[model samples]
Target: MPGPIWTSPAPPGNPAARRAPPAGRFRSWWNSCCKGRAEPSRHTGGIVAPERVDFYVLNQADDASRLGYACMIAAKAWRQGHRVYMQVDTPGEAEALDRMLWEYQAASFIPHARTGTPEAALSPVLIGTECAPEKWRGMLVSLTRALPEGAAECRRVADLIADSQDHRAAGRERFRAYRAMGVEPGTHEIRL
Candidate 1:
């Protein structure tokens, strides 16, 4: 059995409340995630880069719940025959994600890396205190070795992490440029 990484957020002694696991919380999250946002309309837009599927998580009231949703979405996409890239902060978190992915019988694990020192191209999706890439590699290797099977599947998880890193880098660039241009934050209407 996997060790527990989460605590329920429901108030104690609430008989009417459902004590839902991580997956259950995803339902409410997917709904309010973009509340009051304009729905992007369909148009005859020219062929552009394959639309990158994204789930933006600023912070989570329930971290496990958020992670559960992220794992589910990526697994679903993989089932649909799309390549997936998953990223999580720690090896333990990655283990949880790997378990979820394996439940779907996707690919096995492989190293997801770029050439040069790991630090030179370390994943940006890895948030919090700085750790050498070697340390990361060691943790990941140890965790995957303990798995019963599905090494390739772990690679898919890593791919999603890479995707998150790419997304984060793009966001940083946009924000930096926006600040440099002295554009006031918030949506603006322009008659282009």
Candidate 2:
């Protein structure tokens, strides 16, 4: 089993709970209609704005470690009423993500098309996109930097996967050459 990513929970208890209940009495009520758009200004006065939280999971192949981190981030974001999205390049990648989301019990999975080609899958991938009025980018930067050893682990796993793909490609090329020469490609022998 893996440990959690974020340490603490959202503050002020419940976000919705912090909202000021409808003002009581006719004086507070009397303020409405008499003033120009007072209700909208009062509600939108930046006093009770929703805290913005966004989690972006970058491009990933079959590496479960990266997905696990994403799951943790997503779970935290969901708890805070923030929108969560994942960028999936392929059906297989999307399915792997589905399994990760299932494991983490995230609120939702939104698929997105990756800009690069399949070959790019072996490279480092950035997943999530954060947009908010204040410090959202800074938050993401800090979160990524704070990734205890996640980036290193993710890089190692990605390297192993890329190496395997290269090996498979080389084997396919060798087999093709054999077929071109009208000879059997033959099976590979494994030694103990």
Candidate 3:
């Protein structure tokens, strides 16, 4: 089991909730994690890059485009045989994503369910408001301003930045947070 990670938001004025664990302590958890994953590497990582992370820079900041791209990304990953969890900030976003995934492509559909449902465990993709569920930690596509919880345990985390001032600011904060978590995140520009 892994020690507690500050993956979610604490109510305002709760300083401890916002504070992250020390670097050495966090690294220790990653090294000793027994999640049936491959043998631990002697180096400061595993088979993949340390907490592999990627940020997608979007040209348009509109909700439609953001959800569309997220749907596409989730579909591609699912087709490639990787389970994905789409983390949204609230129940409304979760519902929006669930509906968008269904109608994203007229010729195809992406199988998915909300986090608490029975189908979520077996579905290739899951959309949820929370982020710490062990089963949904394979790959995370976060559509929230704050980084989702349990991100350190995920094999890969995909964050998005829409073309808006607020989005950019939030993206910068997450970029810095990822660095603090010992990950050198990769970046990609989405033309559409």
Best by TM-score: 3
Mark the regions of model 2 whose C-alpha exceeds 4 Å error after superposition. Answer: 1-62, 105-192
lDDT (Cα atoms) of all candidates against the true structure: 0.32, 0.33, 0.77
In the order shown, what is each candidate's alpha-carbon RMSD?
A: 18.9, 22.5, 13.8
134: Cα error in model 2, Å: 19
**Clashes within 3 Å, all models in order:** 15, 5, 1
For candidate 3, lDDT tens digit of each residue in 131-152?
A: 6467656678889998777676
List the lowest-lDDT window of 10 residues for candidate 2. 152-161
lDDT of 3: 0.77
User: After superposing candidate 3, which stretches have Cα over 4 Å from the reference?
Assistant: 1-50
TM-score of each: 0.29, 0.27, 0.75
Model 2 clash pairs are 56-128, 57-127, 57-128, 58-126, 58-127
Tens digit of per-residue lDDT, candidate 2, span 37-88: 1112232243321112212323343356555655554455434433333443
Over 4 Å off, model 1: 1-53, 58-60, 102-192
Model 2: residue 12 alpha-carbon error in angstroms:
24
